[model samples]
Target chain A: DAGVTQSPTHLIKTRGQQVTLRCSPKSGHDTVSWYQQALGQGPQFIFQYYEEEERQRGNFPDRFSGHQFPNYSSELNVNALLLGDSALYLCASSPVGGADEKLFFGSGTQLSVL
Target chain B: AQSVTQPDIHITVSEGASLELRCNYSYGATPYLFWYVQSPGQGLQLLLKYFSGDTLVQGIKGFEAEFKRSQSSFNLRKPSVHWSDAAEYFCAVAPDISGGYNKLIFGAGTRLAVHP
Candidate 1:
């Protein structure tokens, strides 16, 4: 009955550096999605992964990539991070077969780019 | 392209007073709508959602939302407000097409401040 969980609650990196954030989906969930929430703004969709493959993506650039493991866990990697990338990286999970099902979210990893 | 809009950037109300947050969306067809609340330094928690049926949907914390297709709006309402209700509320919509993988487009958000 565990909810979605994310690692490295906070991270700090310099421009041009890369970082990887991790997320574990909720119990009995098979789909995982990532989002970026800027200060004073809502979360923006990054991408979604299901069955170890990316199913859908948002308007983000290719620098923002993700992977889904067999256990339904997920990782978001950003290459050549820019100062604008500093934000709260959120992870959300939902069960498959239900398109409009509610999503469970993790506290999110706060990324700070210098 | 689907998008959500929360008109109110911030609102303040008495603890015992009623509350409502306005939300509008732009989409070609009916989209899955949702309302989420996020406390300071926390994640967004789903309050309620409208998928296919029932224009009026009930959610936790006595929060409810009404979906109006004509207006392309989904507004969240609560009969009374609590001090703990002070938080940021977000409105989101997701496409329901076959390729939909629960990718949601969110509004900027409405920050609620409750006074004693």
Candidate 2:
């Protein structure tokens, strides 16, 4: 089966601009989560979406938001991007009940905010 | 708050030698632990996980991890290292929350280098 897939493998945005990254979860998975991996750092949780609703969010600001579709696909939107927003945006997915412990990840979209 | 810490920022080992990467976590109750490996330009791949049961867990790779509750640590080990095993390793922990959705707290990660 195909693993989780993310769109726009790489993206470039300017400060104060907005960007949206897309993700399609692995086959037979329902929940999707987003993470940010900065240079020389591990991935940090951004938020999670389940059943077309946002279930949990991390310490991120309001500028970071996400949506889950019926097909289990997800989109991560960042508004008013800052230079620090430049990082690898990773999309992970898991089954309904095992949303936390059993996760599969996508290659991730490299966001470069200029 | 739950958190994970990987002590080594970088480690270099010769091919065919044994390898060990240290990981420590802080949590109130029993925590779920995991080890993930990431290659350049690739997503993080799950190596193994520890929820309950056996303290010694074997992963897809020639990798294994020992969970020590007493030390609050879970260290990854491999009997022999391969050049292709050179990559970044991450340790993560998840809180035993009521809801099914729990965010993972990841360590800064350890970079492994293998010398042939």
Best by DockQ: 1
| Interface RMSD (Å), every candidate | 1.2, 1.6
TM-score of each: 0.97, 0.97
Off by over 4 Å in 1: none
Candidate 2 per-residue lDDT over residues B23-56, each given as its tens digit: 9999977788899999998999999999889999
lDDT for each residue of candidate 1 in B1-116, tens digit (9 for 90 to 100): 67799999999999999999999999989888999999987888999988889899999999999999999999999999999999999999987456563788899999999999
Against the native chain B, each candidate's TM-score is 0.96, 0.95
Clashes of each: 0, 0
Over A51-105, each residue of candidate 2 has an lDDT whose tens digit, in order, gives 9999888889999998888899999999999999999999999986774458899
Candidate 1 positional error at B18, Å: 0.5
lDDT of each: 0.93, 0.92
Clashing pairs for model 2 are: none
- Model 2 chain B: weakest 10-residue lDDT segment is B94-103
**DockQ of candidate 2 against the true complex:** 0.72
In Å, residue A3's CA in model 1 sits off its true spot by 0.7
